[model samples]
Target: MKTYQTGNIRNVVLLGSSKSGKTTLAEAMMFEGKVIDRRGTIEAKNTVSDNTEVEQIYQRSIYSTPLYTEFMDNKLNIIDTPGQDDFVGGVIAGFKVADAGIMIVNATQGVEVGTEIFARYAEQHKMPLVVGVNQLDSEKAAWDTTVDSLKQAFGNKVVPVQFPVAVGPGFDGFVDVLKQKFYRFKDENGTREDLEIPAEYADQAEEYRLALMEAAAQNDEELMEKYFETNDLTFPEMIKGLNLGILAGSVMPVFCLSAKKDIGVKRLMEFVINATPSPAKDVEVTVDGTEVPCDSSKETALFFYRTSVEQHLGEVSYFKVMSGKLTEGMDLVNPVTGAKERVTQIYAVAGKKKEKVSEMMAGDLGCTVKLKTVKTNQTLAVPSVDWEFKSIDFPQSKFRTAIKAKDEKDEEKLGEALNKYSAEDPTIEVLYAKELKQTIISGQGEHHINILKWHLNNVYKLEVELFAPRISYRETITKVATASYRHKKQSGGAGQFGEVHLLIEPFVEGAPQNNRFKIDGKEMVLNIKGKEEYTMDWGGKLEYYNCIVGGAIDARFMPAILKGIMEKMEEGPLTGSYARDIRVYVYDGKMHPVDSNEISFKLASRNAFKEAFRNAGPKIMEPIFNVEILVPSDCMGDVMSDLQNRRAMIEGMSSVKGFEVLKARVPLAELYKYSTTLSSLTSGRATFTMEYAEYSQVPADVQDKLLKAYQEEEGDE
Candidate 1:
C-alpha cells in the first residue's frame, strides 16, 4: 500500500445513536471506496466496521473500529464509533484523532437523544460535522419531518445540500443543490446517472439552493458580498464558503442517504474529501498547549488514542501520526514514560483485516502491535520531538457495583481481567474500597458494565456476580459530651493500669478553644499545655488539646492517646463510618509508674473517645451528588416523580432545544441504578451525568435504618 501525506488524508469519525445506521453507512462508504467488494449488513455480521464477536451478537458497535478507503486521490480514514451512551468512551477516543465527524441520523426517528449528545460533544471538541440523513428507504421514512427536527435543533445552521427525490420504498435518488443536478441511482449497487431536475421538484430544489447559498455566504465577508450582489455563488466559491462554514462549525450541510441501498454514498464521500479539513490543515495541540503542525518534514510523533487486547494479536495499539513520517522498524521513545519502542509493523486497518503498510505519513491513522510500554492516551515520538499529545477527556462513570468472582477461586483472575478491561476502556473505573472491603467497578451505565461481564464470562471464562456497592458514609457529632474509661489488666505478668478522662464536642471552623467545660451540671477548669491538629484523609479535621495540670498523665503518653483516638476515628462509633470534624480535650487522667505503657494508654483513650462520641449526639452523613439530567419534555413528569421518590431536591429546570434540563442534588445511595432507570423511564431517550457535591446529614428515618442494619450485621459477625 502507498503512504499518503497529510494533505491527501481525511480523518473522520462516524457518530449517531444506536440503530441510526452508522455501521451501515460506514459499510456503504467502504464499498464506494472499493475497500470491500460487497457491503455487509449488521444483521449478517460481516461488516468491516463492527467485526467483533460481541458486536455481532448484539448487532451493534461496541468499540470504535478504524477503517480506511481511498477515493478521489485521498485516503479517507473513518473511525466508526458506537452510538450507545454506555459506550461513549469509544466515540470520545475517536474525537481525539479524527478531524471531523459524520453524524448519521435515523430518518424514521429524526434527531434523537444520541444525535443531540454526539453533536454537543463534537461542538465541544470543535470538530465540524456533516449530517447524513440515513435509512431514507425505510417504509416509515419521513424526510420532511426529519429535516424539520434538524432545523428545530440546529436553527438556521441546518442547510440542506441535497434533498431526497423520493423517500420510502421508492427512494432512489436525490437532487443536489450545490451541483444543480439530479442523481438517480440505477440499482442498489450505487450505479448512478446525472440528469436534470424533474419539473415537479424544480421549484423546491431552487428554494433549497438559495437557502444553501445564503448559509454558505454567512461564513465569509467576501462571499457574503458576492451573494448579496449577484444573488448566487460560483461552484468554487460555494465550495470554499461551505468549507469555511464547516470548519467554523457555523453550518452543517445536510445530505440524503439510503445506506442500505448504497444510494448517495459516493456523493457524500466526495463532499467529505473535498470540504472536510485535512490533517495538513488540522493543527494538533499538545498537553502543554504546544501546537504541532502535521508536516512530514518534522520529527515523528504518534498519538495512541485507542488500545485493545485482541485474541491472537495480544495488544493492538491504534495511533495517528501527529507529525513527520513513520516507517516500519523505526524506533521511537514514549515521551510520557521514556520507554523506547520499535514499530515492527504498520497496518492500514479495515476492521479485523489489516493491510500491512511499510510506512505511514503524518495525519494517517494506523495500528501496530508489541509495544512494551505504550498505552492509550500516551504519545510516542522521536527523541528530538519530545511531544506529548493532550489526552482524551472521557466522561465519568455513573453506574457502580461491587463485583466478585462466584467461585472465589477465580478472584485473582477476575482482578487481572478487570484491570486489563479498564485499561482498554477508560470509562470502566475499578477500585478496591478498603472501607467497604469490596472490589467496586464503575462505568457509564449498567449495560456498559454488563458488556464487560459478557467478556469475562465468554472470553475469560470467569463467572462473576455483581451487587450493590456500599456507600462511603461519614460519622460526626452534634453536641458536647464527656466520658471516662479505666483500663486495668492482670495476667500474672506486669499489670496494665491507665485511666483517661476526655470531653468531646463538634469542631467548627474558626472556633476558639475553651478552657472551661460544664458536664453533668458541674463546672471543671483546666490549664491548656499543648495542642495538635490533623486533617483526616477521608474528609474533615481532628483537633486534640492537652489540658493535663500538674502532669496527671505523663507527657510521653500523649502520642499513644492520640493514636487511640485516631483508631476510633478511622472506625467511627456510629455505623462504623469514618468520623470527622471533632475536637477532643484530655483534661485529666491517671497512669501507673510501672504498669502503664503505650498499649494501656491507647486502650483507655480509644474507649473514652468512643463512649463520648455515642453520647454527643452522633449523626450519620451520606454523600450527595449534583445530578444533571437531559430528558425529553414528554418524560419530564415521570422522571421528576421518580427523582422525588429518591429524596432528590430539585435544584433547577430549564428547556434546551427540545429537551428538558433537570438539575438536582441527590444522595449517592439512591443513585445506584439511576442511569438504567432513567433509560427505562424515557425508553432510552434520556441521558444524565452525576458529580460529587458534599456530604449532608441523613434524614432521621434513614439514619435509624442505617443504625439498625449496622447493628444486625455486627451481631451476625
Candidate 2:
C-alpha cells in the first residue's frame, strides 16, 4: 500500500441503531472502493466488520472494527461501531479518533432509541454527521415518514441532499439535489448512468434542493448574502456552504441508499470524500488543554484509543498519529508512564485482514502489535514532545451481578479473565466488595455482561455463575441508649478485671451537644473531655467523648476502648453491615489496678458498645441512586409502573425530543436486573443512566426482613 498524507486521509465512524445496516453499509462502501471484490451480508457472516465468531453467532457487531479503503485518491479510515446501547463504548471510542461520522437510519424503522442516543452523543461531541437512510429496498421502507421523524428529532438541521426516485425493490437510484443530476443504477453492483432530472421527479427534487440551500446558506454570512441576492447557489458554492454547516453542526445532509443492493454507495463515499471534514481539519486536545494540530511537520505522537487481543496476535493496539510521521521500528516514549516502546510493525487493518505498511502519516489510524506496555488511552511520543491526548470517558454501568467460578479452583483464573475483559472494554467494571464478600461485575446491561460470559465460556473455557449482587447496606441508630459491661478473668497466677459504662446517641450534623441524660428516671450530668471525631471509611462520622470523671478509668486504656468500638462499628449489630453516624461517651468505668490491661478494657468496651447498639433504635440504610430514563411516549406508563414497583421515588418527569424523560431515586437493592426489565417493558426502546446518590434508611418491613435473614444465617453458622 502507498503512503497517504494527512490531507488525503478521511477518518469516519459508522453509527446507528441495530438493524440500521451499519455493517451492510460498510460492506457496500468497501465494495465501491474496490477493497473487496464482492459484498458480504450479515446472514452470510462474511462481512469484514462483523468478522468475529461472537458477532457471526449473534449476527451483530460487538467490537468497533477499524477498516480502511482507498478510493478517489483518499484513504478512508472507517470505524464500524456496534449499534446496541450495551456496546456504546465502541461508539464513544470511535468519536474520540474520527473527525466525522455517518449516522445510518433505517428507513423502515424511522428513528429508534439507539438513534436518539447516538445522535445526542454526536451532538455533545460536536461531530459532523452525514445521515444515510438505508434499507430503501426493503418492503416496508417509507422515506417520507423517516424524513419527518428526522425533522422532528433534529428540527430544520435535517436536510435531504438526495431522494430516492422509487423505493421498495423498485429503488434503483436517487436524484442528487446538490449536483442537480439524476443517477440511475444499471445493476445492484453499483453500475450507474448519469442522466438529467426526469420531469416526474423534478418538482420534488427542486423542493428538497431549495430546503438544502436555505439550510446551507444560514450557516455562513457570505453564503447567506449570495442566497439572498441570487436565490440560489452554484454547485461549488453549495458544497462549500454545506461543508461549513456540517463542521459547525448546523446541518445534516441526508442521503438515500440500499446498502444490501449497493445502490448509492459510490455516491455516498464520493460525497464523504468531498464534503466531510478531513483529518487535517480536526484539532485534537491534550490532557493539559494544549491543542495539537494534525500536521506531519511536528514531532511524532501516537494516541492509542483502543487495544484488543486477537487470535494468534498477542495484543493489537489501535492508534491515530496525532502529529508528525511514524515509521516502522520507530522507538517512542509513553509520555504518561515514561516507558520506552518500539513500533516494530504497523498495519492498515480491514477487520481480520491486515496490510503491512512501512509508514503512516499524522492523522492516520492504524494498528501495531506486540507493544511492551502500551494500552488503550495511552499516548506515545518522541522524547522531545510530551503529549497525552484526553482519554475517552465511557458511560457508567447500569447492570451489576456477582460472578463466581463454578469451581473454587478457577477463582484466580476468573479474576484474570475479568481483568482482561475490562481492559478491552473499559465500560465493564470489576471489584471485590469487602463488606458484601462478593466480586461484583458491572456493565451497560445484562446483555453486555452476558456477552462477556459467552466469551469466557468459549474462549477462556471458564465456567462461572452470575447472581444478584449483595447491596452494601449500612446500619445506624435513630435514638439514644445506654449500657454497662464488666469483664473479669481469674487465672492461676494473675487476674484481669475491667468495667465500662457508656452512653450512645444518634449523631446529627449541626445538632447541639448534650451532657445531661436521664437514665432510669435519674438525672445525670457528664463533662465531655477531649472529644475525638473520626470520619468513617464507609460513610458518615463517629465521635467519641471521654467523659471519665474523677479518673474513674485511666486515659491509657482509652485507645483500647476506642479500638473495640471501631471493631463493632466495622460490623454493625443489626445485619453485620458497617455502622455510621453515632456518638460514644465513656462516662464511667472500673478497673483493677494490676489486671486492667488493654485486653481487659478492649473486651469490656466491645461488649458494652454491642449491648448499647442493640438497645438503640437501629435501622438499615441502603444505597440510593439517581436514575434518569428516556423512553418513548407510548411506553411511559408501563415504564413508570415498573419503576414504582421497584420502590422508586419519582423526582421529575418531562417531555424532550419526542421522548419522555423520567427521573427517580431508587435503592440499589431493588434495581438489580432493572435494565433487562426496562428493555422487556419497552421492547428495547428505552435507555437510562444511574448514578450514586446518598444512602437512605430502608422501610421498617425491609429492615425487619434483613435483620431476620442475618440472624438466620448466624444461627446456621
Candidate 3:
C-alpha cells in the first residue's frame, strides 16, 4: 500500500451488465499496474476488488469495492460496482466518487441492458464515459457487434481511439490509431509487448485515425484551420485534440481488452493515465445551491449518501472530498446531526485492505473512524459552510419481506443491525408498522433484502424469519349516528362524573369542495368566515377565536366535543381503523349546571361518535404503489405477463438498458410476495423498484376475507 499525489489519480467506476467481466476487468487493470503480481480470477473469488465475504460467496460484487493501481506514473482508483439491478445503490455510490465512468460490454452480448442503464446514469451526472469491448480472446467474441451496439445506443458520440489488431481466437493485440503503434498481450494471463502493426490492421487503424482526427479537429478552431491547411496534424496535436473531444463528452474512446486473460490491459492503463480526466479536470459541483470548485486547497464538505459497517472496521463512511483537503484528526461538522467530531484516522481503501493516510485531499476517497450519529445522506463539512448535499434519488424498493426475530430476546439487536445496514444502503429499507405490529423489509428485489438477511445472521449473529409483508389497510365509516355516554364514579368522599353527546357522520358526506363553503347537492357546508359571535366560553371565559358563527353550538362545548371526537377517531368506527376527514355538527344539547362540564361533554361526544359511526358505511382501504422495471428486451413479455397476473395495471413502457423499462401501478397486497414470484419468472434478470403511490378502496371479496382474518386474529389475542 502506498500514497500517491493528485496528478496521478484517475478514479474510474467499472460498470456493465451482468457477466460482463467488470470484476475480471478490474483484476486485470490492477495486475497491469503491478499492484498484484498475478491477476486474480473472479471465479476463484480472490480478486482485490471483490473481496467482501458476500461477494466471494455469491461470486459477484455485492457492493462497490474501491481499489487503486499505481500504473505508469499514475494512481488509478478503480471502483468495481455490482451490475445486478438489486445492487444499483452500489453503482450510484461509485458514480459519486469517480471522476469518470468506464462502461464494459460483453463482446458477444454487445451493449445489453446494463450498458444502456449505467450509461444513462453517467450521462445524467454529466460524467465522462468510455467504453471497453472485453473478452476479445474468446473464439465467439465479436468486437464489431459490440461497437455497433454501443454506437446505436449511445449515438454518434462514441468513437474508437483504438482498433483490435485481430478478431476472435486470432485476436492478440490492439493498435492505437492516435499513437500509431501496435501492442499485444502474451497470453490469457497477461504480459505486454510492443510490435509492428499488422499490414491488414494498418489500413483499419488509418481509417479509424481519420475518424479520430475529424473529431479532434472540431475541438479547436485552430486545429481545424491547421487540418485544412496541410491535411496533416502532428501526433502531439492529434492526441491533444482527441483528449479535448473526450473531455467535452463528444467522443467515448473504445478500447479492446480480454480482462480474463489480462490481454490489452497495459495499453488501457496507459491510455487512462495519459488521457482520462483527473480530479482537477472534473467539472465543478454544487451542494445546496453553493458551488464547490474542484480545489484541494480549501476545507469543504463531502457529504456521504451511503455509510456501512464493515466488519472489524466499526463504522466506515465512503465520501468524495468535494472542496477541501481532509487531514487525519481534522474536525468535521456533521450537517445532518449538527455534531462536530474529529476525524481520527484516514485510509485509502482497496477493497478490504486499507492503507492509512495522513490526509485526504479534495476528490480523494477513503474511510474514517467510527461516527455512529452520522448516518447515510449526511453531510460532513467545515463549520463555515454548514450545508447538506442533495439526496441521491434512486429507484424505490419493490419487493418486501416481513421479518421477525427467531428468538424474541433478539428483537432489539435485530433492529439495530438492520438500521445500520439501511443507513449504509439507499436501496434497502426496513419498515415497522405500529398498527400492523410487524417489521417489513423492503428492497429493490428479493436478492437485495435476502442478502441483507444473510449478512445479519452471518456477520451480526441475528437470526430472523422472513414473512410476507402486510398490506397497509385503513377503516372508515359511511353512515351517521348520534350516541351518548356518561362517565360516573363514586368512592369515599370524592366522585368522578363525565357526560357527553357526539354525532358521527361520513367525513365528507354532502359538501362542496371549496374555500367559500358553498353547499353542494347532499351536504350542508359551514360558513364561519367574517361572522359575529356571542361572547361565550365555559359559561363566561373564552380561550381565543378569530371567527365565531352566531355562537354556533356554544364555542365552549365545541372544544369539548372536538376532544371526544379525537378519541373516537383513534378508537375507529367500522373495523376499528383510524378514521379521517369527517365533520360533525351539534345543534341541540343541554348542559347541567354542575355536572355538564367540558369533561362531561368530551366523554359524551366520544360515545356519540362511536355510535354514529355504526350507521356510516364503513369499508377497508388498502395502499398501492407505482412500480417500474428495467429488464432485457427478451424478458419483456414474461415480465408484463407476470405483472398482469399479479393484478397490476400496465400503464406503458419504453426503451431502457437496451431493453424495456415497464411502468405500472399495483395493489400493495398483491405485491407482498412478488419478490419470490418475479425471481422465478425473470430468471433473475429483471429488477423491480416501487414507492408509495396511492391508497384506494379494497375489493369486496378481498375486503371480506381480510376483515374476517383480522377479526379472528383479534379474538385470539
- Candidate with best lDDT: 1
lDDT of 3 by residue, 1-717 (tens): 455556667888888887898888888777766767787788777888788788888888888887777777777888888887678887777777687788888897898767776776778777777788998878889878878988898877888888775678788888878777787777676666777777878778888888888877888999999998988888878777767777778878888888887777777777776767778655444555766665777666676745767779878877777777887788889865789877888887777777788876677677775875676666788888766776666656667788999999999999998887887777888778776689978887778888998889898898899987665566665555455566665665545455544444444434543222212234533343322222221111111111324542456776776677666665465556555655454434555544446776677767766776666666776777888876778878877887877778888889954668888989888877676676677666566667778657787888789778877878899
Ranking by TM-score: 1, 2, 3
**Candidate 1 residue lDDT tens string, 1-717:** 677878999999999988999889888888888888998888888898888889999988989899989888899999999998899898889888888999999999999878887898888788899999999999999998999998898888899899997799999999998999999999999999999999999999999999999888999999999999999899889999999999999999999999999998999999998888898976788888889999988899999988888868989999999999999999999987899999999999988878899999999999999998888899999998678898889988889999999999999999999999999999999999999999999999999999999999998999999999899999999988999999999889899988999998999999988778777889978677889999999989999999888888999999999999999999999898999999999989998888999999999999999999999999999999999999989999999999999999999999987789999999999998999999999988888889999999999999999999999989999
Candidate 3: lDDT of 363? 71
- Which one wins by TM-score: 2 or 3? 2
Kindly indicate the candidate among 1 and 3 with the higher lDDT: 1
Write one digit per residue (lDDT tens) for candidate 2, span 533-583.
999999899999999999999999999999999999998888889999999
lDDT of 2 at 219: 82
- Estimate the TM-score of every prediction: 0.98, 0.97, 0.84
- lDDT of model 2 at residue 551? 90
Q: Which stretches of candidate 3 lie over 4 Å from their true place?
A: 1-5, 165-170, 187-189, 215-234, 283-286, 300-306, 335-338, 370-376, 379-388, 477-503, 508-561, 589-604, 628-664, 673-689
For model 3 the local lDDT of residue 255 reads 89
User: Model 1, 304: alpha-carbon shift in Å?
Assistant: 0.4
Evaluated at residue 70, the lDDT of candidate 1 is 88
Residue pairs with colliding backbones in model 1 are: none
